[model samples]
Target: MDIQVVHRPGNSAAKLTLDAGESVTAEAGAMIAMSADVGITTTTHKRGSGSLTKTVKRWFAGESLFLNHFESRRAGSEVWLGTPLPGDMTSMTLQRESLIVQGGSFVACESGVEVGVGWQGFRTLLSGESLFWVKLQGTGKVLLNSFGAIYEQPVDGELIVDTGHIVAFNETLQFTLTKAGGSWLHSILGGEGLVCKFRGKGTVWCQSNNQRSFGTALTPTLRARSR
Candidate 1:
């Protein structure tokens, strides 16, 4: 299968080309278009025959409870998939190790890639976001979507990223979530509330804008309009 991303940095969409009898799995409601030769099916079909329990885990992880599967009856059939968020979509090829993603940022993944929830300690509450992370394991192509431009940086030693701006990272990297500055007062006044300090060697992906912050900022205007 071949995938191409279009309308980058804004309303991005994915165009996938499939070989005969080949199949691809994606998040429900992500399909924008598909060729007539492609057959569509939806199921909680997790590998290893994991059925209901596996589907529940994916739901808790913020993915669709049932994944949409598209198969090509003839060679060279194509499909288009899109994200609900107006931002960038990124795709990565994964091996044995898993990629831990902010639950809402997951768009889809090819079959063979497992999706589950990673529970975090209460310490993550200080980050101003939920504690559950979508853990994507196995070997397949994973598509991640974000609320802004996606920037990827390779970390060798240590790196600091705004907690709300981080999209995903390699599970191999060790990270600590803490206040951004010296003290509580400084952290609160500095405008940078929480940051994730990542150590070891791996890649980190950050969004240019924080969707939560954007929503917070827009609430007032929306309320006024509603009134």
Candidate 2:
């Protein structure tokens, strides 16, 4: 299978090409278009699993409880996947490695990749992120979508990132939630709030824009419409 990203940094889409007997698993409602020969199956869990517990965990990770699996019955079949937000999409091939994705960043993955929920503890909840994150591990291509342009930051020692701007990161790094400023009050007053402090050796993928910031910017307009 081959994955191509179209339209680049803004309003990007993932076009996946599959050969006969190949399959891909994706977040529910991610399929925008597909070949007629491709078959889609919706299940509460991954392809062959039926554990409701996993479904509930995925919900906590800000993903659909049900997942969609697309299979190509014939050669040269293709599927287009998109995200709810207008932004960039990228793919990575994992060779027996694990990736920790922020909630709502996942787009799709090859059938060989295992998708599960990773608990980040109460500290993450206070940092304005979901306590549960999507964990992908295995040997296949995994696609991720961001709210804006995506960039990779390699961390050999430590790095500080705004909690709201993260897309995903390598599991080799350890992250802690801390104030952006020296104190919590100063952090809040500075409009930065909590930030993620990643320590260790790995790469962190971040979005150029923050989804919460975008929503906050439009709050007045939405309120005025309701009024």
Candidate 3:
């Protein structure tokens, strides 16, 4: 399958074009447009679009967990899509031809195959691995956007990452959120309360700009309304 990210950084929308007969499945509400022959399906989720015809197998909103899949049959098929969640969903995992994304932040894998997880799940995935277990497959790229200036340290013994700034870390490192600074008073006053601590050795990807706390064109209106 051939794919390309037509839009650069800072754009409101990113386009993914697939070669003829190539198909890909992603979460629902992520598709912008597709060819007429393209097939759209949802799993136990509510879907609606004025531009495209939709069919529901089993529909649920808040309680029912749903995932969407789309496939195209003709070459030069294009889909304009973006993340449906807000900026809080900072991490995502793509594995086994499927993607698991958090509730905040927009995410897309231009091309590749891999699994991804957020700060919580990433710590769980790394709890058992030794320092040497961190691995990066053939040209697999994981994109993570944060809320503040992200910090990183090589995992030799322990590393700390801010809750809002953490993007993604290798599964080989064990992580937990602990109070930074000396005491509770210091932590609160210093403006550095809880930090994601990593123990073991692995690579951590962080963002220079905090995408979670900030706003983007893709940011949800509901979240903006809350603030």
Candidate 4:
């Protein structure tokens, strides 16, 4: 199977070329296009009670609990995948490197990768953010989508990022979500908002824009009709 991310830097998508019998599992609703020989199957993995609970958590986190599998019925079958948001697309080749991604960052992944929920604590809850994130482990290429241009921040000691700007990070890093200032009033007024304090040597990916801020900006115009 061959996967390529094209039209990069903005408005990008993944074009996958699959050999006969090859298949890939993608986040539901990610398929934008495909060739005639490509076949699709949807599964919720409802075989176990444990997975059902996990599925519930994922649903609360703003993600579809089911995965769509695309297979090539004939040689050189092609399929295209994209995110709902307009932004940059990138792929990572993982070999046992666990990845924890913000909600809605995932697009697609090849076989051998396991997707699940990870790392939701009190700090995260206090920030009024989603309680869970998508976690990827095992070995395979995983596609990540961002709300805007994505930047890779290498952290050796400490790094702080606006909570809404985070995309994905490696398991090697430890992070805590907290208010940006010493006092609640200052935190609320300073425009610093919630921030994630990260430590240890690893990498963190952040988006140039914040989704909450974007939504907040639109709320006024959207609600004008109501007034």
The local distance difference test score of each candidate is: 0.84, 0.91, 0.44, 0.83
Q: Per-residue lDDT of 1-227 in model 3, one digit per residue for the tens?
A: 34344333333344556666554444446666766777766553222221111112112111113445456677777766654333222323434333222223323332343222222344433322111111212232333323333344456787776555545565667666577887879986886656768788775655455443354435765454644
TM-score of 4: 0.92
Residue pairs clashing, model 4: none
Report the number of the highest-TM-score candidate: 2
Worst ten in a row by lDDT for model 1:
45-54
Shift of residue 200 alpha carbon in model 2, Å: 0.8
lDDT of prediction 3: 0.44
What is the alpha-carbon lDDT of model 2 when measured against the actual structure? 0.91
TM-score for each of the candidates: 0.90, 0.96, 0.56, 0.92
Q: Can you give the lDDT of residue 131 in candidate 4? A: 70
The better candidate by lDDT, 1 or 2, is 2
TM-score of 2: 0.96
lDDT of 1 by residue, 1-227 (tens): 78899999898998888889878877789899989879888788553445686677667656778777888898899999898888999999999889999867877777768877777777877777656687889998888898889999899999999888889999989999877889979998998888899999999999999888899898878746544
Report clashes for each candidate as comma-separated counts. 0, 0, 12, 0
Give each prediction's root-mean-square deviation over alpha carbons: 2.3, 1.4, 9.6, 2.3
Runs in model 3 with CA error above 4 Å?
44-64, 84-157, 209-227
> Model 4 Cα displacement at 215 (Å)?
0.9
Model 2 clashing-pair count:
0
lDDT of 4 by residue, 121-142 (tens): 7677767666789888889888
Error of 2 at 80 (Å): 0.6
